[model samples]
Structure formats: structure tokens, C-alpha cells
Target: MNTAVPLDAQSRRALLQRISDILLRPAPTWLRIDAEGTSAAQLYKNYLIYLAAIPALASFIGMSLVGVGAFGMRLRVPIAAGLVNLLVGYVLTLVMVYVMALIANALAPRFQGRRDMPSALKLVAYGATAGLLAGALGIVPALGMLAAVGGLYSIYLIYLGAPVLMKVPRERAVAYTAVLLLCGAVAGMLVGWLTALATPGAGLGQRGAATLRLPGTDIRIDAHSVGQASRRLQEAQREGDGGAATRAATDAIGAMLGARIDTGQMDQASRQLEQARARGDSEAAAEAAGSMVSAALGGKGLPPLSAQQLRAVTPEQFAGLPRTAIKAETNNVMGMAFTQVDARYSQQRQQVQLRLKDLGAAPALAMGMASWASSTSESEDEREIERSYKKAGVAFREKYRKDGSRSELSILLPTRVVLEASGSLPIDELKQALQPVVQQTTALARPPA
Candidate 1:
């Protein structure tokens, strides 16, 4: 609730000095900060704003410009999508700092600490300095994992500050820190989920490469060399040789910033595409186009399927139920295309619905489902049983009622397709009906011929 006051040049220098003191001599600095009269608004306007931008801007450059290397290739997110992510992430981070402060204030009384808003804000904002500064490592995508060390150090900073800022006894600081960390972790996950939803293809640490291509020309920028250079840079850093690490970093940056097109490969591809077009070979032409699209999308998506292809795989009946209705559609958004099919079946009082969706170009959705692939869980009560687990390398979730009046099943295929079945039938029967459809759809997931 505290208001901001105008800060002059001298005040700004003192604020900057606080960062080094907090990092190097946190124990004494916490006492000094506890006595300061700085308001919440001033802390945010002069400190947190700039501190939070470090990670956001670093991530933007890392993903949109520097890119990541995988499978001997370099992949960068399209600049426009990266910009959106940067904005969303930056705003969310600022809010998260404030939320953590609020949590600290609320939990202070339980730990025998005073509930003071300004003190709580100072504890969080200053404690986050190490992690925020370390965000610069993101400028080199492959080294991003190293930033976790900074986060671990930040937890120590908070632990040092808790007794001074919140008036908690030294003995209770550890318990307070653990609870605060658990809350921060949950908030971080929520923020990540929201950011992914806002920017679909802007997921961090995404694999694959994107080639630079002109619309009506054969010119292309191959990033394979850049990818190789980045790997070497990572190795040099790991060896802890300062000179070698600096040189490798420079080499990697130069490779990415320089225009190094492979003329011979470009000419060969152009010739093959021209030949396919001149000969009226539609299949060959389509295949060539599909490859280009895949490269542009970080080498992860399949070409759009035709309406006939989707309809052909959709089942007309399930088990002994008669088909009631069916629908298939392809939707294009932001130059990316995906398909979905829906079908309904019924027999007297029994009914079922099935849906198939392609996740080739939907990286965010695919990443969300991929988390389930490595996890297992199950729970049951008197009326129903629910379980989630991986089978044959595929992720599945199922629930069924004891009376057999309702059941549902969801399967995430390795090919990035999601199949769902729900209705009045038993869960086992629903899974049985989906076997044929799953096989056909998996076959259709291959690249265009």
C-alpha cells in the first residue's frame, strides 16, 4: 500500500549498490534493508522492473535469435511469436514477485514474525537479485540449465533475510523458507502454463531447426554449422577454461550472425522441385512443399491431411453400436494447419462419442501431453476407478463408473495425435472400439508422399 517517491541520480546509484551488497554480504545487508524506508511502489518502479526484464529479454534473444541445437540442426522460433512470449512472461514475472511478497506477509504470523507489507516486498525483491542476474545465461540457449544454480543461491538469500525482515526467530527460518519455496514452485508452473497457451509455438527448449527461405527464390540459409558451433561452446564452458570458453562463444555467435548459405544444396533442391513441377508429378511436388513447411516449423509438423483421409479413418460403428453421426474438418490458424474428426454411436440406451485430433503443429499442446508419458497414477472409490499411465510408449487416462453408466478414455499417441472416447459404454469396450481407428490414424501420420 506504500506509494512511490521521485528518485534522483544519487538514489539510483545507491539502489544499484544494493545489488552487489546483497549478493556478497547478505547477512549485514538484510539488517540495513530492514531499516530502510523505501516504499513498495518505489521498489517496483526503480528495481524490480529492470531486474525482471533480464530473464524475459534474455529468453527472447535466446529463442528468437540465438536458437537451440538438436539433431545436428539449429532451430529458432519465429520472431513475432517470440516477441509475444517475451511480453507475457515479463508481465507475469512482475506479478509473481508481488504475489510471493503477499504470501510471505500472510505466513509471517504463523512463524512468529511481524506482518509488514513493505518489509515482505523488500525481502522478495532483493532476494531475487542473484537469480534475475543469472538469467543472462539464457542468451546462450544451451547453457540455460546453469541458471538453476542461481535459483538455489537465491533461496539462501531469502533464508538469510527472513529473520531480519520478518522478525522471525533464527530457528524457524528453515521451515518458513521451505513453505515459501513450495508456493513459488507452484506459481512458476502456473505462469509457464499460461505463457505456453498465449504463445503456441514459443515453448522453451524446443528441439529441431528452421531454415531461412525466400518465397519465390531458391536461396536458403543452412544453420547446421551454427548448431555444431554451439555444441562446441557448451563443451568448452564445461571444461572451465576461460580463454577457450570465450573463443568458442565468439565462434558460435559468428556462425549464427554470418550469412553462410549452402549454394550447392540450394541449387540441387531447386532443380528437383522444378523437375517435379514440369513433369506434373503432384505427389513429388507435394512432398517437396511439405519438407519446406516442416523446416519452417522447426522440423516437427506433418503436412495437413485432406478431408478424405480423415473421413476414411473415422469408424462408422463402435462395438455393436450403430453410427449416428460423423464430422471431419481442417482448420488453419496463423499459417499452421491441423485436423479434427468427431463421431457418435448409439444402441438403444447406450451411446458413445469419439474424437481424433492432430497435434503436429501444436507444440504447446503436445508438450503438455508429453508430461504424462513419464508419470503414473491411479485412484478408486466405491463408485468409480480412475487411472493414468503409459502403455506401449503411449500415454493414457481412463475413468469408469461401477454401474457402467459412464466412462471415458484419452490416449496420447507418440505421433502427436490425441484420441478420446466417452459415453455410456464400459471403459474396456470403448478402448476396444478405438483400436482400429488408432491404427489407421497412426498410419496417416506419416509425411506426405
Candidate 2:
């Protein structure tokens, strides 16, 4: 018989203690959990239920409230849809944990270990503590990748627990863990696919109450529960030390996870800029834009160049070709204003277009543009040749047609500027036309004093 356990203050404290112990001292914690006669129902009711919700609720708040952003575009999942997906994913996670425990018990015999369901459940549940706790990072979408590092750590926990709880020989524990991980990965993919399908625009509509049908069960999400959860989450945020904990965890995880650009800050600054613009507060808007620029620059906190300065660096003529058209403008992206200069030179049927973009304020975009810096490739066919390589400390990509009718050359400067020349001319001619523009833009791309 199973007995229900109420999740009171003591239970919550116990849960936290267990999580910390499992993470910081897995070897001893596994032994303690193995010796305890805890039932699967009690474990699920007191531990897995709350821990799994960390990811589900955090993801809901993140996707629907904080939103997701990249390359100056922000996307927020519909509130009702996000709630629906959260419920579906949460249920799937709980089920998957139990299923994994069952698999662990079944594989115990094959690994020359004891087949104790209770021990298997304890191993799977406690071993997943690190991953479940790390799921809180989903609250900031940009930091979500760091969660995978925690997941990797969970694998290590499982490796440690497999030998303790499952009683598997240390020599065969690696194989046992490998098989379980493969199954877990497949189950995870299925859960993600199903949850995505339940969201709006993913084979489902969000016009009203969302309903999802699973095997032998129908899950319906009403607006009332969604509203209640949102209200409670907001209250918790206002009343709890979640903010401080999140910052501390972020710093600790970042030190282990390495460098990653968080675009959420830029998205928030963009919203502030928009609100300021709505109120016609130019000063506030400028401040918000500056913040956005700083975020985009990976915290370098450099101001963006003005349109006139960018235009001044553009060449009026190139390779004896007269300038035919020139235009300079300031474009706003995610609240950060960037200067771009475009110029065209033409003589007879030959034409070359030069574009100089100041990407100093958008280091993420600049990194993406110059991703081929460490890569080198070349291919030549009967009609065209294409190659990407680094030259003289600059990343360049070039393509030319054998007929000499079209060519393109792109250069990524170290100062975070992108210079490109393309037109109906030879590749050499295009490069020649861009040489002076590249030199000038390189000088102009310096950080503001």
C-alpha cells in the first residue's frame, strides 16, 4: 500500500537537502539512498514532482514572459500554448523517469546486478538531481545550453549510482549506463516532439482552451489554471530569493560552461526602447538603445558609430571605376542602431558594389559572420570556383564564375566590420575595388573613446 505525503516546509527543506547532497556528494548520497527503504510513490510525490516542475514552470515563464531572441528578432510563445506545452512536458518527464527506473531494474540481471525496483527508482531519481536543478536556467533562454552541461554531470551521477544501488560490477557499469542513456535520449526526443506538437502553430491552434490527447488519456489546459500558475509564479518571484539564487547559479555555471552571449538582455533593452518611443521620450529611448548596444557588444560597452562616420570611410571610386551610386543609413536592430554604407562603381558593362557594415555593436552577429575564420575550403568546377579562407589576418570568402560575368568577395575585419563587394566583374576586380574601402572601414571600426 502507498501513502500520500504532504509537501510542507519540512518536506521542501528535505528536498533541497537531498538535491544538494546528491549533487555535491554523489558517492555517499547514493549509499544512503540505496540503504533507505523509500517507496517509489513517496519519491515521486515528494521529490520528482517538484523537481520536474522546475524545468516546466521555468520554461513557461521564459518562453511566454521573458521570450526568446536572436539576431534582433524576439519571439514569445502564446501564454495558453506555453501553459499547455508545460503540462504535457511535465507529465511526460514524470512518466519517463518511472519508465527509466523500470528499464534499469530489467537490465540489472543482464549486468550481473540485483533486480530491485525500489533501488532502481532511487538511483534514477537521485541521479537526476543535478539535471533537474539546472533546468532552472531555462528561465533565461540564452542560458539554456548550460543545462546540457548539468545533464552530462547527471550521467556521471548515474555512473556512480549504478554500481551502488544496482549492485552492478564497476567493470560493467559503463556499459549499463551507456544503454540506459541511449534509451533516455530516445524518450527525451519523443517528449520534445510531442510537447512541440501541442503548442500553437505546431499542428495545434491557440484560439481557445488547448487539449492534448495521449495514449489512454486526454489532457486539457484551461485558462484559469494558466492564470493561477502565472500569478503564483509572479508572487514567488516577489517573495522569494529566487533572483539572488539564479544570479549566483548563473555565475557558477558560467564559469564551468564557458562564454556564451545572452541575447535576452538585448531583447529587454529593445522593449524598454519601444516603450520610451511610445511615450516620445527621446532621452530615455537613447539610454535604452545604449544599453542594448552594450548587451549586443558582449558587455564591451562601446558606443556605435554614426552614419556620417561610416559614410566617410566609404571610398568614392574603386580600381579606376567611377562611383555610380552611394547611400549611407543608420539601421536599428534590437534597439541598437548600426551604420551601413553602400556604394556602387561601374565602367561599361562591368559593375562592382561595395558594402561596409559596422558590426562593432553586434558581436554575436559578427561572430556568426566570421564563423569560417578557422575553416578553409576550396572547390572548382567547369563553370565556377568557390573558396573560403583566411588571408593576412582577415577572413575572406570569394566566388567567381569562369565566364567572368559575376563574382563576389566578402571580408570580415577584426574590428567587427563586414566588407563585401559583388557585381558582374572578375573576382580579382571585385577584391581590388574593396581594398581601399576595407582599409578605411578597418580604421573606422575602432571602439569609441
Candidate 3:
């Protein structure tokens, strides 16, 4: 009787454990997509699209919980419309994706899974992460490059997640994803390049695709034509092609100024002349315009712009040179790194020059305009630091009052460069690169008179 009781007790314990295991088991997330019995190949494109939209879908869900109406706020149609568009996009993509999966399954025919659709959906969803990363890079304005990058990243996600999503082995999924992204990127780039080439006047007007895959590198470049054009304009600035640079700068500035004058417009022509003059480049631009007018009115064919006319371009040329040596150095470093980093800075500087392009009477750019703007007062901290060194007494320099006029544009830069210049040595080369305290101490004691 004891043996029988023990056996029964053991069985009961086993039964209880089994019940617990079943209860605790996690539910699978991939929904069986085709209970409605649609064929697989037809669902490919829609499925792919849905996967891309899911992140936005998840975000919308969270956002909806804020309940503006419950709080007595008026409804905004834009928010709802955007959400609906996203949702509809998601649904459509899912349908196409399922169709894509069926095509693959049919070709193989050895696929024995409870529901292949779930795995395919999951795979696409995973790939979407890579695309999202690429999208984040969309901030860099040159070609829809930022967006292209994000999209490219999504493809990588697809590649990385495919194995898990499709229930395929890692190697196979990676191979598939890699192949798809590579092919897609190439096709996309070729199409964009061809489209740009085909457009009128080398296609500077319509927006270019902002994202592109650089040859041999996974890095994405500008994709959209407009962004591409903007980047090109920006690039021309860095190269310092005076004529092209001015044209690019003016176009960008004009957009900001909302003046809407193209080079062809007489008013645009006049405004350009005015902008040059305003920057102290006015005299030079005027001379150049005068020379052009002279050539039209029968002067010796326009010689390289006279020295007088050249002055106008200088304001545009050195548009954003740093106010201090430190900023200059940092700016220089940003230019040196990345193959085109310098170009980026030049582009920015040109833009600054063209718009705020010339130095105003603002204290930041008041260096040349004023005889002596940098004279410092004998602050308490400066006195303490100086007195301590002279008397051999312990002392520390106190900080000065913050300058309200200081702005990102006006102030000196920090030590580090966002991008390290190519071929820079780690060893200390500059005094600034050395320990800050040491530099600070040295700075406290003035150099030989």
C-alpha cells in the first residue's frame, strides 16, 4: 500500500509539473496569415510593404493612448490621417509579402511548416530595423541619402532577420538578405543616376533621390535629385569654384530668403548684386556686373575679373572662417577627416557667407572691422592666478561671467573633431592637444613680452 501510494504521488507531481509547463509556455507571435486561403505568390509586395510600416504602426498605438478627446481636446485630422495611411500601407504590404513567400515555397515544394506565412512576416519585420537605421541617416541633406541609408539598413535587417523570420538557417538568410539589398541598391542607384542624366539641363531642377550606395562601399550617398543637387551645390562650395559656388550659394540662400528668384530673372540678377554689395562683396560684384555690361556695350572681351571685382568674391570665399584659432583648427580637422569632410565644411561656410556671408558689425566677426575688439579686463580670477604664481601662493582662477552674446556661430570650438582627420597621429603635436590643465596653466602665464 505504501509503494502504491508513493507511485501515485510521483505521478501526481509529474502531472502538476506538466500542467505548469503548458501554462507558462510563451505564445508564438507570428500570426498564421493565410487562413483565408489566398495564394502565396500574390502576397509578396504587400507583405514587404506592411513589414516596413509596422514600426510606425507600433508607435501610433502608443500615441493613441494619450486620449486627447477624453481630456476634452479637439480632434486633429492630420494625425488620424497619417495613422490611417500608415495602417493601410501596412495592410497592403502584408498582402504582397504573403504572395512573395508562396512563390518561394512553391519553387522548393519541400517546405513542411504549419504556417510559412508567419515566418516570412517575421523575417520582413526584422529586416525593417536595418531600413530604419538607414532612414535615420536621412538627416544629411545631400541626396535623399539619409532616407536611402535608412532604407538600405532596413534591407540589412531583412538579411539579418531572414533566417530567424523565414525559419531558415542563418547562412541562408544572410545570403538571401545580402543578395536582395545589394541588388536593390544597385538597381536603385542606376535608376537614379539614369534619371538624373536624362533630365533637362543635367537635372538640377527636380529633386534627386536622396540616398545612394557608393561604389564598393556599403555607405549610402544622396538619394533624391533635389537633395543630390543640394549636396552637389554644397560640394561645389567646398571646392571653391567661385562662379559655380556663388550660383549654388545664392540658390540655397534664396530658398531660405523666400525671394524665389532664379538666375534667369532680372530681379534675381539684381538681388544677387545687392547681396554681394551687402557682404562688402558688393563693389566687386558690381564691377563684374559693370564689366559684363561693358562687354555687352563693346568693351574688350571680359578679361578675368579686374582686381577690384575680385574683392566681392572674398566675402563669399571666407564666409565662415572661424573667429578664433581654436575654431579654425577644429574646423580644419573636420575638413580633413572622411574623404569629403572638408567639402562639407566648405559648403557650410559658403552658405553662411552667401547668406550672412559677409561679416556684419556683430562683435563675433568684428575682428577686422574694429581696431581692437579682443582687449580683456582684469577679472578677479586672472588676478588671483597671476598673483599666486608671482608670490608662490596657492591660488585658482575663478570662471568669468557667461557672455550673453556667445552663440554657436560666435564662440570658439571645443578640442575634439567630430570626424578624425585621415592620417592623424595619436601623439601630441599641438599644445592644444595636450592636457587641458597644463594648457590652461601655460595660458594663465602670458608668453614673453
Candidate 4:
């Protein structure tokens, strides 16, 4: 077993550069490796130990500060528990990489490749660069999908490395890569099982976060709110209100990034406002106040509606359904309210959701539905609602009238009205149930108010 000088500074730097090259330029990168005199111990000491630490540290920080955001909610893990999970997962990943290298050696002979143990180690260690570096993505839980995408790219690295490191023929490289991948998968599951056994509480992706709660008014925020604020800030900037624009931009960034974002600038802005007020500078004081309001509440605050506005947004009703079948719907979003009336039923293991949102929220809801309906992947069978209304679409499933099939219908009516009906029902029955509602809603929508 040959080894490089343990304390050589240049070797350490070379290791870091190699990790970067493998991650960024993997296609030609693998062909450049010498793969000579590489051994399991040397690989582990020089590369695996150092490179694998990136994910562990990343996960620890990600879990502690910016936890996962999914299904319209955010979850955070305790720092102590996140640290433990990180350490355990780190050890497991290191072991998994080594085990995959051994598996590569075992599969090499079938592909007519030379039985070189050092080369196999190089293949596994370097091929994992994309996935290893993607650990930093976990810090922003919303970007986890990007990390998964990065991991998928690592498969290509493995494919490219097979021929260079394993000496497999080009035609046999894919097969060799596939078999080794299968082995890695089995090894991963086995290692995970063992890790779970050893650490009872530190299961992968599990965190001790609080239960999901409906966001309170002015408390809960997400990426959408941040984006809205950014647009508002840009508008303010365009209007030459520099102080207001700066305040709006900061609030927007803080909402999207996290509340833990530094507030020193915001504090400074507040101080400037106070100083201006003390000096009897009314214009500066008013500008500062505008900035503070912009930061505190973007776009007139949550739900962006008022009780008077809700009252003015009239409801649409269905004529065929019994009065008993119809119900008024109100969603109290963080104290911001959106009201509508709906008609629904359950039969034959199927359900229907027929809703009419009022003027206040209808246009936005219609836009969202229209966007989904127009998507190429949503459903193949889509068509215009009717000659009367232009901005509407209906997507139907195959055999939609059959017992288990489904369909979705959306129409943007006049006066900012939105009509939506979705269900799994016989196509004839769904049409019958929806026609009267559509007709009534459309009739009301077509006439000028």
C-alpha cells in the first residue's frame, strides 16, 4: 500500500482541486486521472474523509437555521439533534463510498476490464463529486430538488469513469456502470438499516419540528410574498421614492430568505427616520415612514383584502342544486379573508368541488387555474369553455364518464369572477351538474354591471 506524504501542503491543495475538477468538468476530468498506486486506505485518508465532511457540515447548518419548506409550510430541526443526524449520516456516506468501490472491483471482470483495485477506488471517489458538493443545497430546503438533480448528474460521471478507471470497453461501460449502481443501491439500503439500528432517534430526513399550522396574519410568509414585495419595491423605485423602495426591498428579501437575516440596516433606517423627525424635517420623516410601512406590509398586507372589499365582491350561485346543497365558504388566511359559495357531493367513491370565488380573489385564482390548464403535461384533452367566455379551459381524463375517471373545468367570468369544478364522475353526470352553474355564472358574468 503506497501513501503520499501525510503532511504535504501541496498534496492537500491538490486534493481540493481534484474534488472541484471532478464536480465541474467530470467528462474529461475522469480521463485525466492516473489511477496508479491508489489504495483503499490512501483514498479514504486523502479524499473520502475530507470531501465527505462538506455534506455533514452543510446539513447541520441547513437543518439548524433554514429548515425544509414544503406543502406551503416550513419546518426546522433542533440544533443539537441536527448535529447528531449530520455526524451519523456523514459516517454512513463515507462507508457507502468505500463499499461501492469494492463492488466496482467485483463487477470489473465480467466487463473484460483489468482487475485493478486502486482504479475502482478512484472511480467511486471521483464519480460522486456532483452529489457530494450538492450537500450545500440542503441549507435552503426549498432548493432540495436542485440537489436531487445534481445527484442525477453524478450518474453520468459514474458512466464516464467506468471505462477510464475499470478498463472496460466502451460498449460494455454502461452495463458495468448499471450493475455497480445496483450494488451501490443495495449497499445503501443495508447501510441505512444498520445506521437506523445504531442511532434510534436520528432517522434520515426526520426532524423534531413543530406541527404544521395555518399561518397567522403578518407572521407566516413564503417565497410568493417575497416576490410580490420585490415587484412593489421596483415600482416605488421607479416613482423616485428611494427610501420606500429600499425598505420594501429589504422586507421582501427578509421574508424570502428567513427572519434570522441581519436587521442592522433596517435599524439604521429607523434611526435615520427618528433623527429626521427630531430635526423637524417633515419631508424626510414622511419618507422614512413610507419606507417603514413598505417593509412592514407589502401590497397592503396579508390576503391583500379588506372587509369592505370582501363585501363588494358578490357571490355566484348555482340554480339546480338545492339551497341546502349550497354553502358559503370563507378562508380566513392569517386573518385575511376570502369568501365564496360552493356546492359539493360525495357518491360512488367520488367527490365534487364546485366553487365560485368573488371579485376580490377570483381573477388571481382564475389566472392560476388557467396556467395549470394550459400546461402541456396537465392533460391531453383540453378545450375552450364556450364561445361566450375566452379565458377558460376544461381538461378531461380518458373514459372520464366512467366510474373512476376525473375531469377539471375552469372559467374566468366577467366582474373578475372565477368558476371552478373538479371531480371524478361519469362524464354525462358531471356535465349535467356543471351546466346549470356554468350557465348562471356565465349569464351574470356576460352582462355589464
Candidate 5:
């Protein structure tokens, strides 16, 4: 069969139906059909290119139309930037498909499978049918979570196709699949890193010539001006110069205000400012000033840090903290590292809440005299490690409370990597309780020896 021919109307219909079967039917049937070799070029043309486009186009439309919903509010990406991201994501997917196929072919012999490039390509392309199709739901925004189910099913497809397409022995299929998945995980991380640098919405460290319109003024600020102003503010705060600090902070706040407003709206605001000034509308003037002050005080819809708090907070508290630890990109399973470990004594609760993240794989190392609160024999100990193909993690709880009452639990989820205990027990005790699970996760992250 000549798989090189471009897909026509009938061929396209047949191809779609075939993919439908691969998703719904047992792996044995799809593998048998896929084993009948198809050309890499034709496969890319007929399936990979179009299948990957489904999510890219869907995301573009979704962000442009429905937007991302968070806490009952719709947050939309700029259309131009969204389009750029969509195009970049689509191209990345195409490249990754080829890269994964090459990896599969290279790994085939190690698993005692035949080294067939065409089979490898088919394995990836056809195997991904479930995910690519389900990604179409991204257009709805809210239904984006459904795409994860498709991804899980794709993992099942990979497990099933490995023995048949890779020609690996049945006994070695699981081991072979695991290595293949590890390679994929690494590739995903690299792609995400590159994408972050390319897309320009919230990336902070780049210098650009674009100017931002201030809330109530005709003055436009450039990136260099913003940086200088921020540094001056920091210096003033450090020097304990209250007058200079206030002035510097005001400038930074004014420049940073109206971050969410677009260029057109900013122009409108400028016009409104002039009109209000001409009419002597003190109310409008006062409202604009309040917005500028709020934006300066962490009112930009993000976590706030006041001038006083900024002076007190230092990087020393969060030294050696990682932004992200274990993240399965395709699975959307991410564990963020803890930063700035802290503690506070709650008078009403009569307990010290020691806030922290996993401590360099040694949760119990510095913990002082806090013993394991829960014994495996304890009825409340119900500690069962949750392990699955998609995830492997644990949850730990302290056995004893200082108050001896579970009436109020001080839950600390600084990052997804967290330990919870609701007792008058010292903070170290809570850290100690979480040590086993953190240690287990560290072990799980290691490659099979």
C-alpha cells in the first residue's frame, strides 16, 4: 500500500474513522492494523500535522473568545500574543512528535524490539489519537480538564502498543514503556522552558522599547525608567530614608498601575483625565489617585507586599528554594517547591504553626525532638501511600496535638509540597510527620537501578 499519497476526501474520512476505532476498540485490533507500515512523510501529512492543530486552534479560539475562568472571573490573554503562543505550540508539537518517534526507534533494540522507524512513528501518531481528539474540548475553556482523561487513555494506548509495534517481548513491555515515558517527560520540560522565554505576557526580565500609559497622566514610561525607579525605591527603603522611600514608591506605583488595561483603554483614560481636569471633577481625580495608590500597595490582583513588609522581607529566608520540583507536564501533576519557611504562634489556637516546604529531602533532619505522632497501629493512622500510573505520592498527618483536640486545624499549603498537622505540637513535629512521605517521593523520583 502506497502511504505516500496525499489524503483526499475519501482517504481523510477513512483516516478519521480509523482513529475513532483506535480510541474505542481494543489495542490488539489497532496494533494489528498499524503494524502494516505507513510512510513517515505520509503519516505526518495525514495525521500528525492536522491532529496537533486541533488543540492549537482550540486554545487560540478559547483564549480569544471564552477566556480562562478563575474564581468566577474571566481572564483573557492578548489576542496577538495568544495567536503567537498558539502557533509556537503547534510547531512544537509537530517537532516533538518526530523527536519521540526517533527516541522510540532508538530504544527499540534495548527492549529487544525490532528497530523500525515507521513502526515507531505509527506508535506515537496513532497512539496519541485519544489526546489530540479530546484536546478539541479546550475551545470551551471550562471543559479543559476533560483533556486529562484523554491523556490518561493515551498512556494506556502506549502500554498496549509497545509490545505490538515496538515488538518487545510481553514480559519486558512495562519496563520498556517506563523508559519511553521518562524520555517524553524530559522533552516536555525542555519545550515548556523554551515556550516561557518566547511568549511575552508575564515574563519579567526582558527589556522592551514599548511604553505604558500611566493611569491619569499623558506621561509614558519605558522599561528602563521602571527598573531605575524600582531600584531607587529599594535603596531608599534600605537606607531608612522615609521621604525618599515614599517618593520612589509613588513613582513605581504610578508607572506600574493599570497593568491590566490595554493600549486603547489607556488612551481613553488619558482623555478622561484631561476632561476631568477641565470640568474640575475632584471625585474623578480622587478615584484615579486611589487606583494608583492601590496598585502600589499590591492591588494589581496579585499577592500584596506593602512598603513596610517589603523592608522586612529578605531573600535570606527563602534561600535555596526551587520554583517547581516534580511536574508531569502531560499529566498536569506538579509539585511546587517551598520558599521562605516561616512560623507564627497563634494565641487563640494555642499552637505554633511552622510553615515550610520539603526541606532538601530531609524533613526530619533539623526537626527538634518531635516524635512520630501516628503509629501505623493507630486507627487514625490510615496512612496508605497513593500510587498509580499517572501519580505516586503520599500524605502524612501528625498523631498527637498539643491541645489534644482536633477542633481547629492549622492547615499550611505553602506549596503543593506540604505537610498538615493540627495539634499544639511544635512546628518541628509537623515537619517530622511529613518526613516519611517526602523521603518516599525522593526515592520514587530516582531512576530504577
Candidate 6:
């Protein structure tokens, strides 16, 4: 364009048309290769690609982390630093992929063909393997060259391998892979950058705004308490001296926490700031944030907060909790985990219960699967053992639901059994539960003596 001739209208149009032909020229005559109806053959190769890709990605993440952890002395340093770096690198790698791919695609030749699913899967596998190798090698700061090369190489390799995998022209595969990587990298960077920039509340987009409200009433609280605070705040507003009125009402009700602190900032900054500042800060924002000292209890410090004061605490305070309190909090977490594990076992027993329900609803199939109480053979006797397992399973499940905190009766099989043959039910008081029943059902299937 800079070296263009001064042609007007028709002359310029003719020159532009000639320039287009020259610019859009194809490969050298000798280098041109044809696809030859091998599209179907290439698409079927996806299985091999997947065979290579899946294990590589999984192994890279798992093994690398483990390998880093194996250095017990350096574990504290590298593992901690590596994980944070890996997260950042993983994001940056995506950006790199897009840039490499885009240029390859725009400049490379394209050949149109039907998508071969097998070939596509294979291509992904190859690409994944390339990505994994690059990332794993990059873990050794000095060997990071592998990551850079492997990441870019994966795209080129995908393009090169596309023809064999997808049965398309090699040129087309190269072009597509190159462009795809470039676009993908650009997209990844943008997404990561945007996420980094977003404030925790603002990250949820319009939903965040809709959740919390902004108002001027001297006292502040989260949305959960806003409805309750609104009426009282409105009355305070009518009383004219807003800040002082809010303080007077708040001090009178010494237990009300919303009088001084803003709850929204509480979640973001946490309890550290609340515990730190005490009335002498000069900055207006800092001064405004100070909590009002109540003389109700005559200087016995702040009121004692309950266990459920989580909503009132800030994130920083939560992180920097006193050691003993943290351990107590940890126990609470473990207790929840134990409950979930018990629930999982209960769910498995419920599946058996559903099967029992079907026995009552659809007798024919249930009988076929063995709903009958009568023994057909020693093999049929085996079903009784299976039935007992189910019964015990359900019993333990019920016990779990009642009081999972008991900690002692947490197993699927109890120590006591209530083995029933044909009774209505055992009403004996304080019957001790027996231990696990170990009946061999596999041996019962053998020929009878």
C-alpha cells in the first residue's frame, strides 16, 4: 500500500484485483498434496489420540504435585510456591497457545473437509499430551524451556498430525490448529485478567448489586438484617439528628451489633480491622469506621459473641483466629465431614430399601429376584444372608440419622444382630446389637451334597 502507484478509479481497481491474485497464491506446484478421500480414515483415529492425552494431563497434575511434595525439606517452600505459580502459569499458557495458533492459522493454508470425530478426539489427546509435558518440565525453573516449546509445538504437531488423524489435507489441519491455539490463548488471558480485576462482590455481576443494599443510617449491616433495620433506621431519620440518634438507640440496646460497623466490609476485610482501631484515627474514612464504645456494662470491653458470630466476623479475623479457637472450629468442620460420610452410606442402604419397596409393589419380578421367605436350595439360603446384610445396613443407617455426633456407633455394621426368621418383631428392651455377620454366600452356589 505504501509503494502503490497513483492510479485513479479503473486503473486502481485493476491494480487491486491483480494484487489480490498475487497475495492469495497457493503452495509451490511440487509441494501441493491432495487429501484423496481419506477423511473417514482420519476421523477414526481419535481413540489413539485419547489413549495418549487423558493419562498425560492427569499424571502431570497429580505426579508433579506429589513430586514436589516428596522433597520434605523444600516441601514447604516449593509446593506452596509451585501451586500458586502453576495456577498463574496455567492461565498464561492458555494465552500463549492462542497467540501461537492464531498466527499459524492466518498464515497457513486451509483445506475444508468433514469433521472426523475420532480424528478430533485424537488431535485433542495429542495436544493435551503436549501441554502436559510442557507444564511438567516447566516445573523445574531451569527446564521451563520445555513448557514454552511443548506448548507451541503441540499446536504445530496437531496441525501436522491432523491429516493422518482426521484424513484431511495436512495443510488444512496445520492452519486450523494454529489459529485455534492463538484464539484460545487470547481468550484465556482475557478471562484470567478480568477475574483478577473483579472485586469479590462485583464478581457476581448484577446479582451482587441486587443482594446488598446501600443506605445512609449511621449504622450498617448485611442484606440479611436490612429488612429488620429499615423500619428502625427510618424512624431514626425522622428524629433528625441521624448519627447521634442511631448511637443513642444502639447504646440503649447494647446487644445490637449493627450500630457502628458496616457488615459488607466485614466479609471482605474481616475482623482484624474491627479489633485494631480504637477511636483515635484521624482520616475521616478510618474515623467513620470506629465502633461506638458502650457504657451500658461500664467498660467490660465488647459483649461476648456466640459461636454463630461468623456473619459478624471479617475474613481477616476468621483467618487469624486464636489457636485454640481454630482447633475448636476445625473440630466443627470434621464433624460436618463425618455427617456427610454417614449420609453417603445411608444413601447406599436406601437403594436396597427402594429394592424392597419394589418387592411389595411388583411381586412377580421381586419374587424372581428372591422376595420369597421359603428356601429353594442352599443357593436360596444364600439370599437370607444377603437379606440380613441389608437389614443390618438399614438399622445402622437409622442409628446414624438419629445422632451422628455419637462418634461410637458410626460403622455400617453394628456389634449386635436382630436375626428374625418369622416373628412379628422383637420387643425385648435393651437388646445389645451384635457384631458383623460373616456368612459366605459364594460357597452356597456349589452343588448340594
Best-matching candidate per lDDT: 1
TM-score for every candidate vs. truth?
0.45, 0.48, 0.26, 0.44, 0.45, 0.24
Candidate No. with top TM-score: 2
TM-score of 1: 0.45
lDDT of 1: 0.66
- What's the lDDT for residue 341 in model 5? 34
Candidate 1 per-residue C-alpha lDDT over 1-449 given as tens digits, one digit per residue, 9 for 90 to 100: 12235569897787779887786556678999998999988888888887787888898899999897432345888899888977876777678788888888987896689999999989988988877877777788754633543453465577679899999777666556645644454454455567667978433322222221110010111235445765776677568765675466444433432211222233343355556767888677666544433322233445666656777888777877888888787776434576777777888888787777776664433433344444566777789987778889888988899888899888888787888888898777888888998898878854573
lDDT scores in order: 0.66, 0.65, 0.30, 0.52, 0.48, 0.27
Candidate 4: tens digits of C-alpha lDDT, residues 68-134: 5322334688887777777776777776776877888888986678887788778877777766776
Task: Find the 10 residues in a row with the least total lDDT in model 1.
Answer: 212-221
Q: What is the lDDT of candidate 5?
A: 0.48
* Structure candidate 2, residue pairs in collision: none
Compared with the true structure, the alpha-carbon lDDT of candidate 2 equals 0.65
* TM accuracy, model 4: 0.44
Candidate achieving higher TM-score, 2 or 5: 2
Can you give the lDDT of residue 103 in candidate 3? 34
Could you give candidate 3's per-residue lDDT for residues 1-449 as a string of tens digits? 01112226665574344323211110111122212333334323323332244334533443443322211322332556546633543443343333434433332222122236545544443334334333322222222222322332233334334444455454343323333332333344554455345432322322322223211112222233224345655576467665665465444322221112222332233345455656778465665444322221122211121222212222222222331111111111101111111211224222111111111111111111111112221223321211001112211111222331111111111211111111121112211222332233223321122
lDDT of 6: 0.27
Better of 4 and 5 by lDDT: 4
Tens digits of lDDT, candidate 2, 167-255 = 99875565566556444444444554576666545522222223221111122223333334334434443555455433432332222
Output the lDDT of residue 416, model 6.
17
How much is the lDDT of residue 429 in candidate 3? 26
Cα deviation of 40, candidate 6, in Å: 18
Q: How far is 116's C-alpha from truth in model 6 (Å)?
A: 3.9
Off by over 4 Å in 2: 1-6, 70-73, 200-449
Per-residue alpha-carbon lDDT of model 5 for 12-33, expressed as tens digits?
8978787866754434455566
